[model samples]
Target chain A: MQVFASLLAGLVFGLGLIVSGMANPAKVLGFLDLAGAWDPSLAFVMGGAIAVGAIAFFIARNRLVSLLGTPMQLPTSRAIDRRLVGGSLLFGIGWGIAGFCPGPGLVALGMGEVKALVFVVAMLAGMGLWVLFEARAGVSK
Target chain B: MTIAWSTFTPWSALAGGVLIGIAAGMFVLFNGRIAGISGILGGLLKPAKGDAAWRIAFIGGLLIAPLVYALMATLPMPQIDAGYGALILAGLLVGIGTSYGSGCTSGHGVCGLSRLSPRSLVATAMFMAAGFVTVFVIRHLINA
Candidate 1:
Protein backbone atom coordinates (compact mmCIF):
# COMPACT_ATOMS: atom_id res chain seq x y z
CA MET A 1 0.00 0.00 0.00
CA GLN A 2 2.81 2.39 0.84
CA VAL A 3 4.54 1.58 -2.40
CA PHE A 4 1.33 2.14 -4.32
CA ALA A 5 0.80 5.47 -2.59
CA SER A 6 4.37 6.46 -3.38
CA LEU A 7 3.69 5.80 -7.04
CA LEU A 8 0.54 7.88 -6.88
CA ALA A 9 2.44 10.71 -5.26
CA GLY A 10 5.08 10.56 -7.97
CA LEU A 11 2.44 10.75 -10.68
CA VAL A 12 0.75 13.68 -9.01
CA PHE A 13 4.08 15.44 -8.63
CA GLY A 14 4.99 14.84 -12.26
CA LEU A 15 1.64 16.10 -13.45
CA GLY A 16 2.13 19.20 -11.34
CA LEU A 17 5.49 19.85 -12.97
CA ILE A 18 3.90 19.44 -16.40
CA VAL A 19 0.95 21.64 -15.59
CA SER A 20 3.11 24.34 -13.98
CA GLY A 21 5.45 24.57 -17.01
CA MET A 22 8.26 23.45 -14.72
CA ALA A 23 8.91 20.39 -16.85
CA ASN A 24 10.03 22.77 -19.61
CA PRO A 25 13.66 23.82 -19.29
CA ALA A 26 13.06 26.85 -21.50
CA LYS A 27 10.31 27.97 -19.17
CA VAL A 28 12.49 27.37 -16.13
CA LEU A 29 15.24 29.48 -17.67
CA GLY A 30 12.72 32.23 -18.21
CA PHE A 31 12.04 32.23 -14.49
CA LEU A 32 15.74 32.28 -13.63
CA ASP A 33 16.47 35.05 -16.11
CA LEU A 34 16.01 37.72 -13.47
CA ALA A 35 17.94 40.35 -15.43
CA GLY A 36 15.91 39.71 -18.55
CA ALA A 37 12.19 39.68 -19.23
CA TRP A 38 11.16 37.56 -16.29
CA ASP A 39 8.25 35.18 -16.25
CA PRO A 40 7.05 35.13 -12.61
CA SER A 41 4.90 32.02 -12.95
CA LEU A 42 7.44 29.88 -11.09
CA ALA A 43 7.07 32.04 -8.00
CA PHE A 44 3.37 31.39 -7.99
CA VAL A 45 4.09 27.70 -8.27
CA MET A 46 6.37 27.83 -5.22
CA GLY A 47 3.87 29.90 -3.29
CA GLY A 48 1.02 27.50 -3.92
CA ALA A 49 3.04 24.44 -3.08
CA ILE A 50 4.34 25.89 0.16
CA ALA A 51 0.92 27.05 1.29
CA VAL A 52 -0.46 23.52 1.08
CA GLY A 53 2.70 21.81 2.20
CA ALA A 54 3.10 23.94 5.31
CA ILE A 55 -0.21 22.78 6.63
CA ALA A 56 0.59 19.18 5.94
CA PHE A 57 3.91 19.47 7.72
CA PHE A 58 2.32 21.20 10.68
CA ILE A 59 0.04 18.22 11.11
CA ALA A 60 2.90 15.82 10.60
CA ARG A 61 4.87 17.36 13.44
CA ASN A 62 2.70 15.72 16.10
CA ARG A 63 2.36 12.36 14.42
CA LEU A 64 4.65 9.52 15.35
CA VAL A 65 3.67 7.15 12.59
CA SER A 66 2.05 7.52 9.23
CA LEU A 67 -1.41 6.35 8.29
CA LEU A 68 0.03 3.10 7.02
CA GLY A 69 1.77 2.55 10.38
CA THR A 70 5.29 3.29 9.17
CA PRO A 71 7.66 5.46 11.17
CA MET A 72 8.12 8.89 9.64
CA GLN A 73 11.59 9.20 8.22
CA LEU A 74 11.83 12.95 8.02
CA PRO A 75 15.32 14.43 7.98
CA THR A 76 16.85 15.12 11.37
CA SER A 77 19.92 17.01 10.35
CA ARG A 78 20.02 20.69 11.25
CA ALA A 79 23.63 21.51 10.60
CA ILE A 80 24.07 24.52 8.33
CA ASP A 81 27.48 23.49 7.12
CA ARG A 82 29.71 23.89 4.10
CA ARG A 83 28.23 20.91 2.33
CA LEU A 84 24.74 22.38 2.36
CA VAL A 85 25.72 25.78 1.11
CA GLY A 86 28.37 24.66 -1.33
CA GLY A 87 26.32 21.87 -2.84
CA SER A 88 23.25 24.03 -3.24
CA LEU A 89 25.29 26.76 -4.88
CA LEU A 90 26.71 24.24 -7.31
CA PHE A 91 23.23 22.86 -7.95
CA GLY A 92 22.00 26.37 -8.57
CA ILE A 93 24.73 27.04 -11.09
CA GLY A 94 23.83 23.87 -12.91
CA TRP A 95 20.19 24.84 -12.84
CA GLY A 96 20.93 28.27 -14.21
CA ILE A 97 22.94 26.77 -17.06
CA ALA A 98 20.50 24.12 -18.25
CA GLY A 99 17.33 25.00 -16.35
CA PHE A 100 17.01 21.30 -15.75
CA CYS A 101 16.95 20.17 -12.14
CA PRO A 102 16.68 16.51 -11.21
CA GLY A 103 12.90 16.25 -11.33
CA PRO A 104 12.41 18.03 -14.61
CA GLY A 105 15.40 16.25 -16.07
CA LEU A 106 13.79 12.91 -15.30
CA VAL A 107 10.43 14.02 -16.60
CA ALA A 108 12.02 15.06 -19.86
CA LEU A 109 13.93 11.78 -20.03
CA GLY A 110 10.65 9.93 -19.59
CA MET A 111 9.27 11.88 -22.51
CA GLY A 112 12.09 10.40 -24.63
CA GLU A 113 14.10 13.56 -25.09
CA VAL A 114 17.60 12.61 -26.25
CA LYS A 115 19.05 15.65 -24.58
CA ALA A 116 17.49 14.56 -21.31
CA LEU A 117 19.04 11.13 -21.72
CA VAL A 118 22.47 12.66 -22.04
CA PHE A 119 21.92 14.86 -19.04
CA VAL A 120 20.54 12.03 -16.92
CA VAL A 121 23.45 9.77 -17.70
CA ALA A 122 25.95 12.42 -16.77
CA MET A 123 24.03 13.24 -13.61
CA LEU A 124 24.10 9.57 -12.60
CA ALA A 125 27.81 9.39 -13.27
CA GLY A 126 28.32 12.45 -11.12
CA MET A 127 26.34 10.84 -8.35
CA GLY A 128 28.46 7.72 -8.62
CA LEU A 129 31.56 9.84 -8.21
CA TRP A 130 30.17 11.23 -4.97
CA VAL A 131 29.62 7.75 -3.60
CA LEU A 132 33.18 6.92 -4.47
CA PHE A 133 34.48 10.08 -2.86
CA GLU A 134 32.53 9.50 0.32
CA ALA A 135 33.79 5.92 0.63
CA ARG A 136 37.39 6.99 0.14
CA ALA A 137 37.03 9.83 2.64
CA GLY A 138 35.48 7.52 5.27
CA VAL A 139 32.42 9.73 5.45
CA SER A 140 29.20 8.19 6.59
CA LYS A 141 26.42 8.85 4.16
CA MET B 1 13.65 43.77 -15.37
CA THR B 2 10.66 43.71 -17.61
CA ILE B 3 7.86 41.38 -16.66
CA ALA B 4 7.15 38.84 -19.34
CA TRP B 5 3.45 39.49 -19.03
CA SER B 6 2.75 37.79 -22.29
CA THR B 7 4.20 34.52 -21.08
CA PHE B 8 3.47 34.62 -17.35
CA THR B 9 0.93 32.04 -16.24
CA PRO B 10 -0.17 32.53 -12.65
CA TRP B 11 -3.33 30.45 -12.53
CA SER B 12 -1.93 27.28 -14.03
CA ALA B 13 1.23 27.63 -12.04
CA LEU B 14 -0.68 27.93 -8.80
CA ALA B 15 -2.96 25.03 -9.68
CA GLY B 16 -0.01 22.85 -10.55
CA GLY B 17 1.77 23.83 -7.37
CA VAL B 18 -1.20 22.84 -5.31
CA LEU B 19 -1.13 19.42 -6.93
CA ILE B 20 2.55 19.10 -6.12
CA GLY B 21 1.90 20.05 -2.53
CA ILE B 22 -0.83 17.50 -2.22
CA ALA B 23 1.45 14.80 -3.55
CA ALA B 24 4.16 15.70 -1.12
CA GLY B 25 1.62 16.02 1.65
CA MET B 26 0.16 12.60 0.94
CA PHE B 27 3.56 10.99 1.03
CA VAL B 28 4.26 12.44 4.43
CA LEU B 29 0.82 11.78 5.80
CA PHE B 30 0.30 8.20 4.65
CA ASN B 31 3.65 6.93 3.49
CA GLY B 32 5.83 8.63 6.11
CA ARG B 33 8.28 10.16 3.65
CA ILE B 34 9.17 13.27 1.71
CA ALA B 35 8.58 13.34 -2.03
CA GLY B 36 12.03 14.70 -2.77
CA ILE B 37 12.99 13.68 -6.30
CA SER B 38 16.75 13.96 -5.97
CA GLY B 39 16.97 12.18 -2.63
CA ILE B 40 14.72 9.43 -3.91
CA LEU B 41 16.80 8.91 -7.02
CA GLY B 42 20.10 9.30 -5.26
CA GLY B 43 19.20 6.68 -2.68
CA LEU B 44 19.16 4.10 -5.45
CA LEU B 45 22.93 4.33 -5.72
CA LYS B 46 23.56 2.66 -2.36
CA PRO B 47 21.20 -0.26 -3.00
CA ALA B 48 20.01 -0.64 0.57
CA LYS B 49 17.84 -3.65 1.28
CA GLY B 50 14.06 -3.15 1.53
CA ASP B 51 14.45 0.51 0.62
CA ALA B 52 14.54 0.36 -3.12
CA ALA B 53 11.02 -0.70 -3.98
CA TRP B 54 9.06 2.44 -3.16
CA ARG B 55 11.67 4.65 -4.75
CA ILE B 56 11.71 2.69 -7.98
CA ALA B 57 7.93 2.45 -8.02
CA PHE B 58 7.57 6.15 -7.52
CA ILE B 59 10.00 6.83 -10.37
CA GLY B 60 8.16 4.35 -12.53
CA GLY B 61 4.99 6.30 -11.94
CA LEU B 62 6.77 9.51 -12.78
CA LEU B 63 8.03 8.05 -16.05
CA ILE B 64 4.52 6.95 -16.94
CA ALA B 65 3.08 10.40 -16.28
CA PRO B 66 3.55 11.49 -19.88
CA LEU B 67 1.61 8.56 -21.16
CA VAL B 68 -1.22 9.34 -18.77
CA TYR B 69 -1.21 12.99 -19.74
CA ALA B 70 -1.15 12.07 -23.42
CA LEU B 71 -4.31 10.05 -22.94
CA MET B 72 -6.09 13.11 -21.62
CA ALA B 73 -4.63 15.78 -23.87
CA THR B 74 -1.72 16.48 -26.14
CA LEU B 75 1.54 16.44 -24.25
CA PRO B 76 3.01 19.84 -23.69
CA MET B 77 6.24 20.42 -25.54
CA PRO B 78 9.27 20.98 -23.29
CA GLN B 79 11.63 23.45 -24.85
CA ILE B 80 15.14 22.60 -23.66
CA ASP B 81 17.49 25.12 -25.18
CA ALA B 82 20.75 23.90 -23.66
CA GLY B 83 23.24 22.30 -26.01
CA TYR B 84 24.67 18.83 -25.41
CA GLY B 85 27.83 20.03 -23.72
CA ALA B 86 25.96 22.40 -21.48
CA LEU B 87 23.42 19.75 -20.61
CA ILE B 88 26.11 17.27 -19.64
CA LEU B 89 27.94 19.81 -17.56
CA ALA B 90 24.76 20.89 -15.87
CA GLY B 91 23.83 17.29 -15.17
CA LEU B 92 27.13 16.57 -13.51
CA LEU B 93 26.94 19.68 -11.43
CA VAL B 94 23.40 18.96 -10.35
CA GLY B 95 24.23 15.37 -9.49
CA ILE B 96 27.24 16.22 -7.37
CA GLY B 97 25.79 19.33 -5.80
CA THR B 98 22.52 17.80 -4.73
CA SER B 99 24.40 14.87 -3.24
CA TYR B 100 26.61 17.17 -1.24
CA GLY B 101 23.68 19.34 -0.18
CA SER B 102 21.46 16.30 0.44
CA GLY B 103 18.48 17.86 -1.29
CA CYS B 104 17.32 19.64 -4.41
CA THR B 105 14.41 21.91 -5.28
CA SER B 106 11.77 19.46 -4.15
CA GLY B 107 13.60 18.48 -0.99
CA HIS B 108 14.99 21.80 0.14
CA GLY B 109 13.00 24.24 -1.97
CA VAL B 110 9.48 22.90 -1.54
CA CYS B 111 9.30 20.39 1.31
CA GLY B 112 12.02 22.00 3.37
CA LEU B 113 10.39 25.41 3.25
CA SER B 114 7.13 23.79 4.16
CA ARG B 115 8.67 22.37 7.28
CA LEU B 116 9.93 25.83 8.27
CA SER B 117 13.33 24.30 8.72
CA PRO B 118 15.98 26.93 9.25
CA ARG B 119 18.58 24.81 7.50
CA SER B 120 16.31 24.42 4.52
CA LEU B 121 15.71 28.15 4.52
CA VAL B 122 19.43 28.80 4.30
CA ALA B 123 19.88 26.22 1.57
CA THR B 124 16.99 27.64 -0.42
CA ALA B 125 18.29 31.17 -0.11
CA MET B 126 21.79 30.14 -1.12
CA PHE B 127 20.63 28.22 -4.14
CA MET B 128 18.30 30.97 -5.31
CA ALA B 129 20.94 33.62 -4.96
CA ALA B 130 23.42 31.47 -6.82
CA GLY B 131 20.90 30.82 -9.56
CA PHE B 132 20.21 34.54 -9.88
CA VAL B 133 23.86 35.40 -10.11
CA THR B 134 24.64 32.58 -12.52
CA VAL B 135 21.87 33.62 -14.88
CA PHE B 136 22.90 37.26 -14.65
CA VAL B 137 26.44 36.34 -15.62
CA ILE B 138 25.47 33.92 -18.38
CA ARG B 139 22.77 35.94 -20.10
CA HIS B 140 23.73 39.50 -19.22
CA LEU B 141 27.41 39.68 -18.40
CA ILE B 142 29.13 36.97 -20.44
CA ASN B 143 26.96 37.31 -23.51
CA ALA B 144 26.48 41.02 -23.14
Candidate 2:
Protein backbone atom coordinates (compact mmCIF):
# COMPACT_ATOMS: atom_id res chain seq x y z
CA MET A 1 0.00 0.00 0.00
CA GLN A 2 2.81 2.41 0.84
CA VAL A 3 4.58 1.53 -2.38
CA PHE A 4 1.40 2.14 -4.34
CA ALA A 5 1.05 5.54 -2.74
CA SER A 6 4.61 6.39 -3.66
CA LEU A 7 4.01 5.37 -7.24
CA LEU A 8 0.91 7.52 -7.39
CA ALA A 9 2.81 10.44 -5.89
CA GLY A 10 5.57 10.11 -8.43
CA LEU A 11 3.06 10.01 -11.23
CA VAL A 12 1.41 13.19 -10.05
CA PHE A 13 4.77 14.84 -9.50
CA GLY A 14 5.96 14.00 -12.99
CA LEU A 15 2.75 15.28 -14.50
CA GLY A 16 3.22 18.48 -12.56
CA LEU A 17 6.74 18.84 -13.89
CA ILE A 18 5.50 18.52 -17.44
CA VAL A 19 2.52 20.84 -16.98
CA SER A 20 4.62 23.48 -15.23
CA GLY A 21 7.12 23.51 -18.08
CA MET A 22 9.88 22.33 -15.78
CA ALA A 23 10.62 19.37 -18.05
CA ASN A 24 11.78 21.80 -20.71
CA PRO A 25 15.40 22.86 -20.38
CA ALA A 26 14.69 26.13 -22.16
CA LYS A 27 12.02 27.09 -19.65
CA VAL A 28 14.31 26.36 -16.69
CA LEU A 29 17.12 28.33 -18.27
CA GLY A 30 14.73 31.21 -18.84
CA PHE A 31 13.91 31.39 -15.15
CA LEU A 32 17.61 31.30 -14.17
CA ASP A 33 18.56 33.94 -16.73
CA LEU A 34 17.82 36.93 -14.51
CA ALA A 35 20.07 39.21 -16.52
CA GLY A 36 18.34 38.23 -19.72
CA ALA A 37 14.75 37.35 -20.56
CA TRP A 38 13.45 36.15 -17.25
CA ASP A 39 10.33 34.04 -16.97
CA PRO A 40 8.66 34.36 -13.57
CA SER A 41 6.39 31.40 -14.22
CA LEU A 42 8.61 29.01 -12.34
CA ALA A 43 8.43 31.27 -9.31
CA PHE A 44 4.70 30.78 -9.27
CA VAL A 45 5.27 27.05 -9.45
CA MET A 46 7.53 27.17 -6.39
CA GLY A 47 5.14 29.44 -4.57
CA GLY A 48 2.19 27.16 -5.14
CA ALA A 49 4.15 24.08 -4.14
CA ILE A 50 5.41 25.74 -0.97
CA ALA A 51 1.99 26.99 -0.04
CA VAL A 52 0.54 23.50 -0.06
CA GLY A 53 3.68 21.86 1.30
CA ALA A 54 3.75 24.21 4.26
CA ILE A 55 0.31 23.09 5.30
CA ALA A 56 1.14 19.41 4.86
CA PHE A 57 4.34 19.75 6.85
CA PHE A 58 2.42 21.45 9.62
CA ILE A 59 0.09 18.48 9.84
CA ALA A 60 3.01 16.03 9.67
CA ARG A 61 4.78 17.79 12.53
CA ASN A 62 1.96 16.97 14.92
CA ARG A 63 1.76 13.34 13.91
CA LEU A 64 3.99 10.64 15.39
CA VAL A 65 3.45 8.22 12.55
CA SER A 66 2.24 8.40 8.98
CA LEU A 67 -1.25 7.40 7.93
CA LEU A 68 0.16 3.99 7.00
CA GLY A 69 1.80 3.55 10.44
CA THR A 70 5.38 4.20 9.36
CA PRO A 71 7.58 6.46 11.42
CA MET A 72 7.83 10.02 10.15
CA GLN A 73 11.36 10.30 8.82
CA LEU A 74 11.97 13.99 8.34
CA PRO A 75 15.49 15.36 8.39
CA THR A 76 16.65 16.60 11.80
CA SER A 77 19.89 18.28 10.78
CA ARG A 78 20.18 21.99 11.53
CA ALA A 79 23.82 22.84 11.15
CA ILE A 80 24.84 24.98 8.22
CA ASP A 81 28.37 23.90 7.34
CA ARG A 82 30.88 24.12 4.50
CA ARG A 83 29.64 20.92 2.91
CA LEU A 84 26.13 22.27 2.57
CA VAL A 85 27.16 25.59 1.09
CA GLY A 86 29.85 24.20 -1.18
CA GLY A 87 27.71 21.37 -2.46
CA SER A 88 24.82 23.73 -3.15
CA LEU A 89 27.08 26.13 -5.00
CA LEU A 90 28.36 23.34 -7.18
CA PHE A 91 24.84 22.06 -7.79
CA GLY A 92 23.68 25.52 -8.76
CA ILE A 93 26.48 25.90 -11.26
CA GLY A 94 25.57 22.57 -12.79
CA TRP A 95 21.89 23.57 -12.92
CA GLY A 96 22.78 26.80 -14.71
CA ILE A 97 24.96 25.00 -17.22
CA ALA A 98 22.54 22.22 -18.09
CA GLY A 99 19.18 23.65 -17.00
CA PHE A 100 18.32 20.15 -15.79
CA CYS A 101 17.83 19.20 -12.17
CA PRO A 102 17.29 15.62 -11.02
CA GLY A 103 13.51 15.43 -11.28
CA PRO A 104 13.21 16.98 -14.69
CA GLY A 105 16.39 15.29 -15.89
CA LEU A 106 14.90 11.90 -15.12
CA VAL A 107 11.62 12.83 -16.71
CA ALA A 108 13.42 14.05 -19.80
CA LEU A 109 15.34 10.81 -20.05
CA GLY A 110 12.11 8.85 -19.78
CA MET A 111 10.85 10.87 -22.69
CA GLY A 112 13.77 9.61 -24.77
CA GLU A 113 15.88 12.74 -24.90
CA VAL A 114 19.40 11.65 -25.83
CA LYS A 115 21.17 14.47 -24.02
CA ALA A 116 19.15 13.78 -20.91
CA LEU A 117 20.22 10.15 -21.11
CA VAL A 118 23.82 11.30 -21.13
CA PHE A 119 23.18 13.56 -18.19
CA VAL A 120 21.56 10.73 -16.17
CA VAL A 121 24.44 8.35 -16.91
CA ALA A 122 27.01 10.96 -15.94
CA MET A 123 25.02 11.82 -12.86
CA LEU A 124 24.99 8.17 -11.78
CA ALA A 125 28.76 8.06 -12.22
CA GLY A 126 29.11 11.15 -10.08
CA MET A 127 26.95 9.61 -7.39
CA GLY A 128 29.09 6.49 -7.52
CA LEU A 129 32.16 8.64 -6.88
CA TRP A 130 30.44 10.07 -3.80
CA VAL A 131 29.83 6.55 -2.52
CA LEU A 132 33.56 5.83 -2.82
CA PHE A 133 34.44 9.05 -1.02
CA GLU A 134 31.94 8.32 1.75
CA ALA A 135 33.42 4.85 2.28
CA ARG A 136 36.91 6.30 2.52
CA ALA A 137 35.74 8.96 4.98
CA GLY A 138 33.88 6.43 7.12
CA VAL A 139 30.58 8.19 6.66
CA SER A 140 27.20 6.52 6.27
CA LYS A 141 24.23 7.95 4.37
CA MET B 1 15.72 42.06 -15.43
CA THR B 2 12.71 42.00 -17.69
CA ILE B 3 9.98 39.41 -17.29
CA ALA B 4 9.13 37.39 -20.33
CA TRP B 5 5.45 38.15 -20.09
CA SER B 6 4.71 36.76 -23.51
CA THR B 7 5.97 33.33 -22.69
CA PHE B 8 4.90 33.10 -19.09
CA THR B 9 2.02 30.86 -18.08
CA PRO B 10 1.40 31.69 -14.46
CA TRP B 11 -1.88 29.83 -14.06
CA SER B 12 -0.65 26.54 -15.43
CA ALA B 13 2.54 26.82 -13.45
CA LEU B 14 0.61 27.36 -10.27
CA ALA B 15 -1.76 24.51 -10.99
CA GLY B 16 1.11 22.24 -11.79
CA GLY B 17 2.87 23.29 -8.61
CA VAL B 18 -0.23 22.46 -6.64
CA LEU B 19 -0.15 19.01 -8.12
CA ILE B 20 3.48 18.61 -7.12
CA GLY B 21 2.72 19.82 -3.63
CA ILE B 22 -0.15 17.44 -3.22
CA ALA B 23 1.92 14.60 -4.52
CA ALA B 24 4.68 15.36 -2.05
CA GLY B 25 2.21 15.83 0.73
CA MET B 26 0.59 12.51 0.03
CA PHE B 27 3.93 10.75 -0.17
CA VAL B 28 4.93 11.95 3.26
CA LEU B 29 1.53 11.50 4.83
CA PHE B 30 1.07 7.96 3.62
CA ASN B 31 4.59 6.67 3.16
CA GLY B 32 6.52 8.82 5.64
CA ARG B 33 9.09 9.61 2.96
CA ILE B 34 10.19 12.85 1.43
CA ALA B 35 9.46 12.82 -2.30
CA GLY B 36 12.97 13.78 -3.25
CA ILE B 37 14.04 12.53 -6.70
CA SER B 38 17.80 12.53 -6.21
CA GLY B 39 17.62 10.82 -2.85
CA ILE B 40 15.22 8.27 -4.22
CA LEU B 41 17.41 7.63 -7.27
CA GLY B 42 20.50 7.46 -5.09
CA GLY B 43 18.87 4.78 -2.99
CA LEU B 44 18.54 2.66 -6.08
CA LEU B 45 22.32 2.78 -6.60
CA LYS B 46 22.90 0.86 -3.37
CA PRO B 47 19.68 -0.94 -2.79
CA ALA B 48 18.99 -2.35 0.65
CA LYS B 49 16.71 -5.23 1.54
CA GLY B 50 13.00 -4.53 1.04
CA ASP B 51 13.76 -0.92 -0.01
CA ALA B 52 14.00 -1.28 -3.75
CA ALA B 53 10.34 -1.92 -4.56
CA TRP B 54 8.90 1.52 -3.79
CA ARG B 55 11.84 3.34 -5.34
CA ILE B 56 11.44 1.33 -8.52
CA ALA B 57 7.72 1.97 -8.50
CA PHE B 58 8.22 5.69 -8.08
CA ILE B 59 10.72 5.87 -10.93
CA GLY B 60 8.48 3.75 -13.10
CA GLY B 61 5.65 6.18 -12.45
CA LEU B 62 7.81 9.12 -13.45
CA LEU B 63 8.80 7.32 -16.63
CA ILE B 64 5.22 6.39 -17.52
CA ALA B 65 3.60 9.73 -16.80
CA PRO B 66 4.87 11.24 -20.06
CA LEU B 67 3.27 8.54 -22.11
CA VAL B 68 -0.03 9.15 -20.38
CA TYR B 69 0.31 12.87 -21.06
CA ALA B 70 0.98 12.18 -24.69
CA LEU B 71 -2.46 10.64 -25.01
CA MET B 72 -4.00 13.96 -24.07
CA ALA B 73 -1.65 16.37 -25.81
CA THR B 74 1.91 16.87 -27.00
CA LEU B 75 4.84 16.67 -24.68
CA PRO B 76 7.28 19.56 -24.85
CA MET B 77 10.59 18.86 -26.51
CA PRO B 78 13.45 19.78 -24.17
CA GLN B 79 15.75 22.44 -25.58
CA ILE B 80 19.32 21.92 -24.42
CA ASP B 81 21.68 24.63 -25.62
CA ALA B 82 24.78 23.24 -23.96
CA GLY B 83 27.22 20.99 -25.79
CA TYR B 84 27.77 17.36 -24.80
CA GLY B 85 30.92 18.15 -22.83
CA ALA B 86 29.18 20.81 -20.84
CA LEU B 87 26.18 18.60 -20.28
CA ILE B 88 28.34 15.75 -18.98
CA LEU B 89 30.26 18.06 -16.69
CA ALA B 90 27.07 19.65 -15.42
CA GLY B 91 25.50 16.25 -14.72
CA LEU B 92 28.53 15.13 -12.76
CA LEU B 93 28.57 18.26 -10.67
CA VAL B 94 24.84 18.04 -9.93
CA GLY B 95 25.06 14.39 -8.90
CA ILE B 96 28.02 14.92 -6.61
CA GLY B 97 26.65 18.13 -5.20
CA THR B 98 23.20 16.78 -4.42
CA SER B 99 24.65 13.72 -2.71
CA TYR B 100 26.97 15.86 -0.57
CA GLY B 101 24.39 18.57 0.03
CA SER B 102 21.70 15.95 0.78
CA GLY B 103 19.01 17.50 -1.40
CA CYS B 104 18.10 19.17 -4.66
CA THR B 105 15.51 21.70 -5.85
CA SER B 106 12.51 19.57 -4.94
CA GLY B 107 14.00 18.35 -1.68
CA HIS B 108 15.62 21.51 -0.37
CA GLY B 109 13.78 24.18 -2.33
CA VAL B 110 10.25 22.81 -1.93
CA CYS B 111 9.94 20.33 0.96
CA GLY B 112 12.67 21.73 3.23
CA LEU B 113 11.59 25.34 2.85
CA SER B 114 8.00 24.35 3.48
CA ARG B 115 9.04 22.78 6.78
CA LEU B 116 10.89 26.01 7.66
CA SER B 117 14.22 24.26 7.93
CA PRO B 118 17.15 26.63 8.44
CA ARG B 119 19.49 24.28 6.63
CA SER B 120 17.17 24.19 3.63
CA LEU B 121 16.95 27.97 3.60
CA VAL B 122 20.72 28.35 3.53
CA ALA B 123 21.12 25.63 0.94
CA THR B 124 18.44 27.14 -1.28
CA ALA B 125 19.96 30.61 -1.08
CA MET B 126 23.44 29.33 -1.85
CA PHE B 127 22.26 27.35 -4.84
CA MET B 128 20.18 30.22 -6.17
CA ALA B 129 23.06 32.65 -5.82
CA ALA B 130 25.41 30.21 -7.47
CA GLY B 131 22.97 29.66 -10.29
CA PHE B 132 22.61 33.37 -10.89
CA VAL B 133 26.34 33.94 -10.92
CA THR B 134 26.99 31.01 -13.19
CA VAL B 135 24.36 32.13 -15.64
CA PHE B 136 25.73 35.65 -15.61
CA VAL B 137 29.25 34.44 -16.27
CA ILE B 138 28.22 32.03 -18.98
CA ARG B 139 25.78 34.28 -20.80
CA HIS B 140 27.60 37.60 -20.54
CA LEU B 141 31.22 36.93 -19.69
CA ILE B 142 32.13 33.56 -21.18
CA ASN B 143 29.40 33.60 -23.85
CA ALA B 144 29.21 29.84 -23.63
Put down candidate 2 lDDT per residue, A50-69, tens digits, no spaces: 99988888999888899999
- Model 2: per-residue lDDT, tens digit, B31-133? 8878888889988888799999999989888888788789889887778887899899999999999988888999999899888999999999998888888
Summarize candidate 1's per-residue lDDT along B1-144 as a digit string, tens digits. Answer: 899999999999999899889888998999889888889998999999999999998888788877788889899979988899999999999999999999899999999999999998998898888888888899999989
What are the clashing pairs of model 1?
none
iRMSD for each candidate structure, in the order shown: 0.7, 0.9
CA shift of A86, model 1, Å: 0.3
Go through the candidates in order and give each one's DockQ: 0.87, 0.83
- Of the true interface contacts, the fraction found in model 2 is 0.80
- Candidate 2 C-alpha error for residue A46, in Å: 0.3
- Worst 10-residue lDDT window, candidate 1 chain A: A101-110
- Per-residue accuracy of model 1 over A1-141 as CA lDDT, tens digit each: 989999999998888888898999988989999889999999999999999999999999889999999999899999999999999999999989999989888888889999988998988988888999999999856
